[model samples]
Structure formats: structure tokens, C-alpha cells
Target: MKVKSVIVPSGMEHLTKFTRKIPSDVNVVPVTNDDSFSNIPLKILHPSKKGRGKNEDSMVLYGQFGLKSFIFMGDLDRRGERQVLQDYPSLKVNIVKLGHHGSRTSSDPNFIKQLEPELAIISAGRHNRYGHPNQETLNTLKMENIS
Candidate 1:
């Protein structure tokens, strides 16, 4: 199936944000809390801030199909996670892609508890400088028993 639309953060251009092929007629829209994709049954959520910068505004993506649900967090920090928790109190998914590669600045314990996912994945680089997948985050995951 063709990609009908791509929802990105407000004011973000296609060229800088992506490397894939996007057809001219496909709708490229901004990410908003209220909007969601129909074809893939995915809902995109972003921080309150509109401007793009070093600030963490990771767009949390929730993809649900049939009985399985997945939450993919893109470099989201603690604040952004808090915003998500506040916005969606019932925001629990089966699988979660950890934020900021499990950096100390992300993956708050409360947030983990809320999610209560069966499996958690961290997209961390091998021996990266940032010390991704921090020990604290791992400990939190272990404490929560999120495999």
C-alpha cells in the first residue's frame, strides 16, 4: 500500500527530516495530539513546544493493530514523557521503544510503571559516547520487570 500521509513536527521540512521517497501528492502534515493515521492505526504525539531545537520534543508514536500495541518514543526526555503521561493517563502499550537510548535524562520510573509493557527495546548504538542505555534506566526496567 502507498504511504498516504507523513505526520511530522510543525514547521519541519521533508528534506531535512527524512531520506525516504515521498510522492508529491502524499499529504505531509504536522504532528498534533488530536490527529492520527488511519491506514496503519498509528497515533502521533509530541511535546507542547512547537519550535525545533536541542530541546527534547520526541514524537511518541503509538501503533496498534489487532491485539498488539507498540509505543515508539523518539529521543524523548523526562519532561516530554511527563507531558505524554499527563496528556494520556491511560497510555499503556504492549511494546515500547525507549527514549534517548535509555539515557539518564529519560525513561522515568513513573513513566515505565504507567506503560507496563511486556517488552521494551532500546535503540542504542554500540559503545556510543553518550553512554546510552544508562545503568539507571536498565535498573528501572529491571525493577519494573519490563523485559
Candidate 2:
């Protein structure tokens, strides 16, 4: 695999430990703002403004594979979404990987309306303790008419 670099969330260097073997040439980048991988379609979009505590959902990436455009929201909450929307008012995406484990805290109504994704992908574990993919999120998707 020819990998140029591995970008990760800010303050999340510890997650790198799970990887098997990283080539010496690959530079692991931790993003603090909206940055894109040069010569690659993948990008990291930090929704939160500076000084937003921890920013666990720091590595928000807008990516494309084949002809599909999508964005991955890494546990981003409403506040983050608000900030992202405020910055990129006209942002649009074909698909959106729901953030905050589909918790109500993320995927705000106005934010979803702005993106108007053609499809919504919710990641969750079966019978998980957190009860992720909350009904409110599902209802929001339904209300938005996002498949």
C-alpha cells in the first residue's frame, strides 16, 4: 500500500497504537483546521473553532471514492455542526456518515438541511450500552427525507 500520510484527530495520537505497521515514509498528521491531503481527494475539516475543548471530533473528513462525495463526521456534536455550517454556509455533500454515534447531540436539523445528503449512514453497535442511533436522529433523518 502506497500511503503518503495518516491524518488523525487532534489530541488523538494514542489511537495510532492500534495500527499494525506504519511505513517509515508515512507522516501521521494531526489536523487543527480544514486541511486536505495534497494529490488526494480525502480531506480533514475541523468544524469547531479554536478553543473548543478537546475537539474529539476533530478529524472531520470530506472524501470521495469513485464518483461519490461524502463526509465523515467523527463524533461531532451540534455545536461543532453549527460552527461548520457557519463557516461553510453553502457546503453540500452526497453522503454523510452520521456523527456522535447517531446521538441526538449531533446531526442538528439545520445542519442536515444545509448538507441535504442523498443518504445518511449511521454507525452503531447492536444493543450497545449507549443506545446510540437515538430515535431523535432517526426521526430527523426521516423528517429530512434522507434515505
How close is every model to the real structure, measured as TM-score? Answer: 0.80, 0.78
Whole-structure CA lDDT of model 2? 0.78
Report how far off residue 124 is in candidate 2 (Å).
0.4
Let me know the TM-score candidate 2 reaches against the reference structure.
0.78
Each candidate's number of clashing pairs is: 0, 0
Off by over 4 Å in 1: 1-6, 14-28, 53-55
Clashing pairs in 2: none
Candidate 1: clashing pairs of residues = none
lDDT of 2 by residue, 1-147 (tens): 587877666555455453436666777665666555577677667733333324445557787788888988888888888877777788899999989889999999999999989999989999999998999999999999999
Clashes of 1: 0
Please list the C-alpha lDDT of all candidates, in the order they appear.
0.79, 0.78
Best TM-score among the predictions, by candidate number: 1
